[model samples]
Target: MKLWKSRSGVAAWLVASLVFVSACSGSGGGGKASGGAESPPASSAGSASQEKQSQEAAPADPLGKYDPPIEITTVRIVNDTYKYAEGDTIDNNVWTRSIQEKLGITVKNNWVVSGDAPGGQGEQKMNVSIASGDLPDFIPVNSRQLKQLVEADLLMDLTDVYEQYASPFTKEIMNQDGPNALASATFDGKLMAIPNTGSSMDGTFMIWVRSDWLQKLNLPEPKTMDDVFAISEAFTTRDPDGNGKPDTIGISLNKDLYGGYAGLEGFMNGFHAYPRQWIKDESGQLVFGSIQPEMKQALAKLQEMYKKGEIDREFGVKDQGKAAEFAAAGRVGMHFGQMWNPLWPLVDNKKNDGSAQWQSYPLVSVDDKTAQPRVNLAVGTYYAVLKKANNPEALLKIINLFVETGWGESTTPDNYAEHFTKDGVERHKYIPFQAWPARKNLDIHLHLLEAANTGDKSKLNPEEQDNERQISEYLSGKEGAELGWAYERVFGKDGSFKVVDKYVSDNLILPNEFYGAPTPTMVEKDATLQKMELEVFSKIIMGDPIDNFDKFVSDWKKLGGDAITAEVNEWHASK
Candidate 1:
């Protein structure tokens, strides 16, 4: 066994275990085919018949079940929100049972850990597994872990397996965002891992405003940054809620300035400045975005807003949940967030005050130039196999066939309802590996819109049928409207994803220039640099000198930011 001095070192070792085992110990049980017991032939005719039966018994289909059971060992991250059917567990559910019965494979969890557990204990356990060289047949890991494993040469090359075993639908789903999605998992011209693809649009930001407040104040919908400023100022000072108190805030912000909700990243995008991202300059060299001239302008505006009491005075201490209280209580009128914002704190606002009506709009630009929502590539997780595993291709075939059988075009409504969506149980959670099409949600919305327009549900898929009914109930203002309300906000005629579709069509998204694994300097000094950035930016937002922005740029460059930049550019150039 290899000893590691640190958790990252252990993680790197664990990642490379499969390769190490394959190189040292040779291939193992994963590749062998199990055969039935043969009987001695009594005559020539019997021998010929037995030979024909043997040929027929061989597993020929890509998704064909193993004649004898095959067991794969791994660990599981049990999501806190996952719901199970009565008497079902992580090891025994419709998903797991189906895999056993249909695929002739059993998944044995070496251990199970809570996804929401504190201190990242699950990841720490994984590191221990690596240091001991006691790795399972296969596992899913993040980009950083995957990178370490690749560097250590402890993973299998999955290029041929994927090409040979992946179903056509799976291939289409993985490639929807183009080569970058797959390129993230590719190292040195070899596909090192199977990328878990998610919708890039899910990360795109938008400006969500309370429509009822807009109507109360008689303000036109925000179409420009100036309009947004005017609305925020009016909401703050004019008592749009009619409580006759100066207790309202213009826009809600959180302690973490960059995230999916209550973040300033979207707000900065309005000014054509992307903070905490890597962007390309006019000369085509990648640079850190936080120190750009555009960022200084944005910081100045935020500082002005802070001094005018338009932003939360205690925002530096408030996290997303804490700052969300203002929105939930209807004390705030506008915030910059993502598509799902309406389903969350805004939903709480509606419940608290039925009069609160929120709507999503495309981000407004500061000038004539359109504001493009900054989106990083959504390839976060990867599935890699140990080289010693007999059938590394089995993972590919399993995911491909599982998706097709359970949720693809070939899926039947009856089977889907019975095995997958029953009683709100997330049956998909039981599958050891999970992947989704990049356009799954957007496609659902398009279908929902079509169904709404035509007033017909005959052509809708099973999931869409359920959504259509929920949206109809909400629009009709029936009992149990809250459930429908959330669905409508996400999938109805004026759903938040409508803007996502428009952005996709117009190509208005600014993807991060750097999506490769973390650079050496980044892995070493990124945390410190990030902390400094947040502190300086927070102080500036809370009334520090605007010139402090320049000082921050200087400090950031001196404190490892320059090294990180060089490393990122080097990676970019090599790619």
Candidate 2:
């Protein structure tokens, strides 16, 4: 099923963003408080220490200071699997509830609409507000739409608010939680939005192959890019499934709609040229990946595969879901995904006998040349906010509570997970840590495993709280195998923990630290230009002639690609 469609219908999409600052000057600081003024109530604690903390920390106020209940008006943006329920207005979602009960803020839904609805009412509502000169106190917008919002000047400046209102905890999160978390949110040295900060963990075009198929085919697991071709060829031609039909495909990938890492073109990562990643060359000049000479070779290989009937013929039009469906039903031999791919449409199918039976593997070294793999990692979706939010420092305050509650050095996993589970609003949809930021640390997993197995989660130090909670939940039979793996690593004294521990100990987790910021070029350019890029890239991967790929490069440059490059570099220089 399609989770959430992109929102659309800005009456004048370009104009809104083009003249945003000029348009939204006086739109802020308006309206009388709606709904009865009432502070969020105290929460239920499943344990004593948690109850003590709740009692001592002031009920339902994570922002540190409990202000008189202020009704915060906000526009809701529905994401995948996160939607508006019937008779369940936006004011009653897990996010709003967390804001009220934890921060003493009352949330009011000023506008509500669905992405799946026709005419893009949800997206249009925000556009209409901008056009009509009525901006809500807060709007949770994705990065894609954030550019438009920035251009339209519909959002609060957040510069003064961030500096003055942000708590030390929130500041630390933006500054210390790896690199680029806040950088992505900041534009021209101003805090535009509170970007989400977890997608950074994702990298590489992870390919999920059938482990059982490998064993059945009597073939060794693939270790290099050449092996990918061999394995795919075997699956397609050698009857790896034993069903005797040549129905199996070597690989299934979607070109259109998906974009970036998981898209069909992402397979090009094995060829060492990430199709969507705009990287600096040896001379520090910005360049598009698809136009690189390396890409020609990659496309040539893909074309050869397509001609061999090893690839799915329907690739050109297939979307992520459709391509993934083929793999899930055992019709495709291999599929590319992020590390968490199996947890989604594929894993969801495990209930059905026809569910995609798959296994995860790291990116194979292709060409026997480049050892480094190229993967795109996104930073944050949209920072959520409560409406009529009086606590400008609310984000910081909640981060503080979560940080302290996570691994404040003396906390234990069992205690933290039990409390977090009891207080958990939205369950992590994919990874165990998706719901909250603090749950991402691997160390926290170690502590939680200790707590869960010993029945004393509180024994874990605060420093290990997040990972510990994850482990505790998993060991306690929570959803997600990754969590279970963490638990086993800790309690079973498994080698995985030792390996991860060493990585952490030596600080071996080296992620790209790009200086990211939205540029006026992006705002100035027409959306069609980028849309064209996605379309052409998709076509090239779906068996479009290798020469057509050359045309795409020229077209991209002519269509604002060069301008965007200059703009990005200019922004980088200014920073």
Candidate 3:
């Protein structure tokens, strides 16, 4: 059964592609094959001698150049912001040249599309290729597409190739997030795709507050919900920006209400409520977290804050970019967001007002129970090989090259800068496929912090050593003053990842229970349910009667909630 249908936009394109593929496959015999003349059959004794000679001539070398060049064809996604050097095209750049030289592999693009396009055309092109049965030798696809390909029996089982060809570092990265990362791409106990594991901590939310404003108001760092409320009121009414007008907002939030940035998910987590996650109840049944009693309590608190003018009065109308204007203008003092906040609007705030000081802290708890920020496993992209391809192991070799040269101990500072950083060129883009350990960056920070404290760099890996040097230079007030901003936020004494480390050590992380494909009911009803949820929550925060929440819960159950609950439980039971 199809788990989901394309409702609109990219989904529509995917659905169309699937239908086209099915139709074309049903009407076979549309294309012809051609090849050069074949050599005459050899005697059994002669064949055995030739095989022995071949084995002796070509010893195994993962990074060694192929004796005869091999060409791999695939599509490309070009970032709009990317600028090419003088005459370099997307297909003929430093990365492609490097691959040709180091691995004797030539990459040819069948088609190229801009990744920044509005309609996900890159994915659409891929869908067309899949439908036409003209797939590239290797391709990167989402979980849903990967499922379709696997169900069609068009993809090669990479279990053996991965086992035999994957470098130790590549294997280490794949297992960084536990087997779940690989499990996402596993079918019938066989590995079909190379999962692109992402950092789990990327979704953890922390309170980014203006330390300058806190000091200006003589308030201590917030430790509880009460302190948070008090600080918000003061920042809003007490003129924390030092301007005569009461223009500062206590906190900034966008219309989405629940995202990694400028959303209320983290704030609600402080009340022990988790929305957008599947949680187990007292009955041991999987249920959606949005309609729980804890959510009502959290909404009530937000309502009170809204009435007191601590929250933006027009937040329901503001998108993330629009809401971020308050922060960029130094008119907002706090927000609950991910670790990357300091690298963005906060950095803009610093450039606009040099005195603006923002620091990241763990989320404050509403009560004595420690508040744990919610995170989700972020393995969504996967690389698959065509079943008819001659050398599926080449993909694994390319992955080894990426890891070794990018993050492994073999990386050199000079080569890294030359290929990856020179002329602001992103050579990693030329690599048709890549994957990394989810916790790679956090591990780097931990190593850098260790080296910083011990005054010994011997234990640092090559990547960490390079970062340490740059951060050290920035800390010492070296000539490249502007270069220090990113390092200071990500790896310095009070860097953002330090908070992530604290979360890890304290066992203060809540992960989603449901990590598999969407359920049948969910695929059909989730969008409608989510719309109702956002409307009801926004209304509650805008001072609608608290009773509306109970009605919402009842209505939710009546509208496919019960069926979805059963489906989710069935999945959980199977696991």
Candidate 4:
């Protein structure tokens, strides 16, 4: 049995009934892959063009000659299901140790656990610290938890810290990524945390139809919602795979709600019935999107599909992974997901049978509507930092390190690269995944990593050589391989670059008005509202009477949904 503590200072032990916690855990330039078209014929080089490109300098060092070094102990929470390299430990890894060595920083772990839940000893340790009022210098918390901490005044205002010390590169990213992200982390006009950035890279999600199946059936790819229906009809009626058994389904829905909502409702958006997560109605009152009349129409269409045997009947229990399995097995005709879906899940499925030919299609609105598919801009899921032990500037220092190391630069200088090579540390080791240098200077590193992975530098352009250097350096060390492996996984030969390219070329990004963290009113009711949302959504999707939706909406309003909206709107108005 194991005991865990909650934030309120209660000691709870884990019994056989409890689950175990595990160790804590790029987008790019490229041409699009053809639909059902085998690999686009490779281009033949006329002659290898070798020109060393001019490189940019590192951002000016921000912490100019501070007297004595300050030590800060930051407590980090990593995902439980993280697959660590063979010898990797929570205390040491390529990512964390690089900061310690390069910047004279020391990050001490108070406790660590896996999953969003702070389970077992990790939760217990955090609770004990809170009860004792001995919290660490910095705790990078989740959005929901951040709301609680803001009410408690346990966080430091980062506005002044950011203004004084933030590197130009990071500042530029803030502007490029949009102010809504900052708005999410600010409270009372003071920035509370450094918001994480996701490439507002538009069009990451698309409709994936089985190209081989489409060819077998001689059906055209869907350009609109109606086309989607037609294809699904054919996929279900005529055995597209020519298999003897009639086991094919037109579409497989995960019923996961959030991920699919954007795609499913995207069709409704074409009809001007935009079923947004948060929307304002005719009376200018903020309302939830799930209960909207528009959602009913969307559900009705899905219900029709379900009745027609077009949608998978077992969607309720099928997770994203399982849905991918059905698609790979050729039992499902279409699925909606981000562009990276193929190499991530489908490409891997080729292990079972190499002929699983899947491709992406931009499902344009059927009504000739120009309303581009709206994708959400992510602010900060993985973006967090540890506070310095006694010195308040420690957090700022770490941010500065992330910026100066490669924030504005194309690649680290050759001298620094050499230094990294000699020390057995990667020049890009301290470079956080979201930094500007990593994002903008990608062409350089692309050439480099590709050369190393495929062992052919002649194929790389001058810019790609930079990426190759960092990739090679990263793979040389015992610790560096963790980061190296992650990079390769994202952009390698079988990486997500191809699908990501297509997505970026299409879609519209809706920059939501990022509100501050949850307020006191939400403390008592947020959980109830969340539960209500899932219950109502599940019931409606599972063929509950349409009238039940009205009842659900009424119940939701009564159960803190209205209050939460009022609080959110009040904050929104202030912003």
Candidate 5:
């Protein structure tokens, strides 16, 4: 009954029926939770091909039960924080039981890794599987790995299975954000994988500055690139920590440049230099952002800041976690990161130093042109079936059941509690196909904002109701206010969602032009290229010659960069 408009808002109101549309919206720095999800977009029922390769499966049903039942193997990623009730596990839990009981699908895990983050155990195990060609029946992979599998001719073409078997609800949820999710997984117009979609718009970056430091130094907030530098200088030199030892850093950064916290992506965006993004050129051709001439300008600015002792010298060696220690110790004043940053390292600042008040501001441009935050296609995980598997359509049915249980008519209170989460346990994690619409978190933000304004708690669900209570407690200065600071900064008035609205209104969130899976040359050479880029950029920021960037651009092109660009353009042209 509500219509919201934004970058990732529901493009069609018809898809909003009978759904709570809430969960995991904030794409935080690291471990960005499915930019929290709700329902999906409309479904497309037709495809180029639909192959029948089931060993023992009936015609596709939106919630059809399997007669004999089939077992599908998969690998999973879970973090240490995951909690489960007694007698429940990643294998024998409510969701796995539901898949078997409802759909007659026995969900089996070939391997389960502990950490779910990039470069964690999950990815390592997956890489080993890719190398050995030993992937399970139902596969969970990233875009790059998906490309590798497709190139190796290992994945089943779900083109027909998804179209014919996916329920209207499942279809809508998958494509809710846009065609990019499906488009990304399409290989030569074949839907080779199911994109576990997240919201790219939620991953947009902003500057998280220490407002206390700003007020203490009598500095104006950054509206332009100059203001950013001036604030950094003032923070570094003025002893804003009030300890008079010149022990503070103006800006903080991690060893990895693109980290979610203490990252430099926002800083580069200010200069209109979108590193790690493939953006469009004036002629509408796709070009890599790091190689653009504008990148040199951003690098030059960072080099200047480094020379002036405004940036941390150890930043070149510190990771995001290590860089955050400077904030907790109140030695750094400003940095660029995602909206969920307050939950992590920044929250530590509030607890450690009572005067440390941080706020997020839109990234200011170096020039008159607005600096748009660039984010990659937000489909973090892809579920695929091996072409050799007997039950391809079974995956689709399982996915449909998951969707039905979450948002469809089956979404009763008992289903939401027992199957989804009970006693703070993420029961849904045990499900094979975990997905939601990109608009879910934004919807939560809108409803929370409206409730704050009108005292109307009628529209909020149980999850949203609890969130409102936490935010209310934070705002009312109740006990344990520090615990609610993250919620308040995220959901309260003038929260990060308000900023998300502004970016959408201004149309300033620049998404990467290349959303399709990695190209052939990209699969072969992207790793080397990314490493070279990070090292070169780090050296330049650490006072390397500015002209070194030109050399990097030349070298990057020579070393398969040219090939990758041609393949990217080829993919783009074909699209």
Candidate 6:
């Protein structure tokens, strides 16, 4: 097979990155950093190197260290999963120290906030900071917040600095997914923020199934919507778990119906419904997906499934984490999720039950029409330099180093262990200024697939090489080898990436039509409408009349959705 070229990202659709910069101008004086934020430098052993950097003049050396060094304060949204080495903190990790040693940059966090999810403490604290008009030198914000910052004129336009300071390899990584990522960061022809480009085309949802259970139940693999529904029924009622009890669940789903895991996007796609997307109608007008007739039909099928005891009655209260527990316990036989999900709840289930064997399949169509899963791989996090920061180019330099260490010619295996990660610890995320090559993971999958076929893995990068080793051990069936099967499921011949290949090769991707900033009407009303839609959908799925969908459609239009559609189309026209 020819190699695939693309990247993927974490649960971008699931993670809410809510930010809003107020009209208040940046105080210019930095905010009070938690823990006084004093120490962010290379170890004293590098003092001579620091002195050497201090003696040199600033140059456009893509990886050049600053003369005399420079300090840039920023805030961070620390994830729950972040674990540091001893004597290290979020602002003083391997990444921070590497920046000090290699770039002569001292990066400190103005304040550390907990959790990166939307409406989490990090989002709330950032909102308060925005309201207080205290921002760090270079701050990361989401698309929603970037739009407001652009309107407030509180951010530096990075067009010139990016063009001048970015290395050729860095530029290649930034635009790896073509111009869409950069275009998303651009406003009024100026690049206001450096987009942390992510995977979109490679990020579509697929149906993950308990393949062993299918074999146990004497069932065929799924090819159409009928087969999917049939499998759900058999898994739910046929004691697929062999417990002689009707306890196995048909499908696993989270309360938030659209995410990388346990979401209904793949299920919705079965009926030609693309929720949370903007698609051009036959009339050539951009239309919202949630309110379409297609969505209602899909919802009706889900409602029917819920009524048939295939779905959990109280799913509205369960988040993805909680929903993952059911799958981990081996009660769930199928799900709709992104490609990375096998490494998560599915792996847990496999580890829990050695007999468990889950696999991903392309989302199938309900009729003669092909299924097209909606995907939004747009850049979510953007690093914007403060309008009054001392060094805007520092952001570019840091990103350059970040990219170089991970993907550029300067990269070595040591770079991955030293600055990017350490023994699976994702220290690369702790860096204040960071961006990823958009197609890195997809490239890994392709490389591994080719290596698996040819048995020649010399050209594989560090990450791909590690995955190859894990897959080898798993296939060897060594002690505790099954744990590595998650990697196998993602990169092996039968892995989820193979399903991704099929979906892309067969041209079944339904890319989001709208990727611009939230239109004015959407800014004001989108959240409320989304809330209403979810509540209505949950109600209908849990025994409420299906006609409620009709009411929801009417109310959505009346409550600013029509206006938002108009604004969206206007932006589309401008594009």
Q: Which structure among the candidates has the greatest TM-score? A: 1
Superposed model 1: Cα runs more than 4 Å off: 1-61, 116-119
Write down the worst ten-residue block by lDDT for model 2: 21-30
What is the per-residue lDDT of model 6 for residues 1-575, given as tens digits with 9 covering 90 to 100? 11111111232222211000000001011111112122123212211233224324533455666667888889989876677888889978888887887777898888998777666788778777777889887888878788878888787777766766677766776775667788888887888889876556557788999999999999999999999999999999999989888888799877877776778888999999888899999998999999999888888899899888898777888887788889989988999887777666677788899889998898898999988877775577889876677666678778877766666644667766676456545566687776655456556677777777887887777666777787789889877876478778876788887887776668676668888877888879989999998899888888898999999999999999999999999988876
lDDT of 2 by residue, 60-120 (tens): 3334435465555555554333324344344564445555665565656666565623335
Q: Could you tell me every candidate's TM-score relative to the true structure?
A: 0.87, 0.68, 0.84, 0.70, 0.84, 0.85
* Candidate 4 per-residue lDDT over residues 73-115, each given as its tens digit: 6564544333334575666665456555555556676666554
In model 1, the Cα lDDT at residue 232 comes to 87
Q: By TM-score, is 1 or 3 better?
A: 1
Question: Between 4 and 5, whose TM-score is larger?
Answer: 5
Instruction: Give the per-residue lDDT of model 3 (tens digit) for 1-575.
Output: 00111122342233322211111000011111111111122112211233233334343344555647778877776655456688888888887887777777788988888863423877777778889988887887877678788889887877766765577667877876567778878877778888866657655888888999899889989889888888888999999988799788888878878754578888998998999888888988877888899999999988988898889999999776677778889989998887666555566687788678888888988999898887776775689877766566677777777666666555556665555555545555567777655566576677667777898888765446656776778667775443355557765678788898898878787678777666788779988999999999999999999889999999888898888888888878876
lDDT by residue (1-575, candidate 1, tens digit) is 00111111222233222111111100011212112222211111212232233335432244556556677777776655567778989889887787677667788888888752322766677767766867776777777778877787677777766665566667776787667888999888878889877667766889988899899889999999999999889988999999889999888888878765688888899999998889999999999889999998998888888888999999988777777789988899999987666656677787888778888899998999999998788776788876655456457656865556544655667766666556655456577775566665676678778776887777676667777777788789896577577667766678887988999999898889899988899888989998999999999988889899898899999989999999999999888
Candidate 2 structure, TM-score to reference: 0.68
TM-score-best of 2 and 3: 3
Scored against the true structure, residue 308 in model 5 reaches a CA lDDT of 87
> Predictions ranked by TM-score, top down?
1, 6, 3, 5, 4, 2
The positional error of residue 449 in candidate 1, measured at the CA in angstroms, is 0.7
Cα RMSD for candidates in order: 9.8, 11.2, 9.8, 13.5, 7.7, 8.9
Give me the runs in candidate 2 sitting further than 4 Å from their true place: 1-62, 67-69, 79-89, 92-102, 116-120, 142-177, 255-262, 348-357, 368-377, 380-391, 398-544
Clashes of 6: 5
| TM value for model 4 | 0.70
lDDT of each: 0.72, 0.50, 0.71, 0.51, 0.74, 0.74
Off by over 4 Å in 5: 1-61, 68-70, 75-83, 110-136, 148-155, 387-391, 404-414
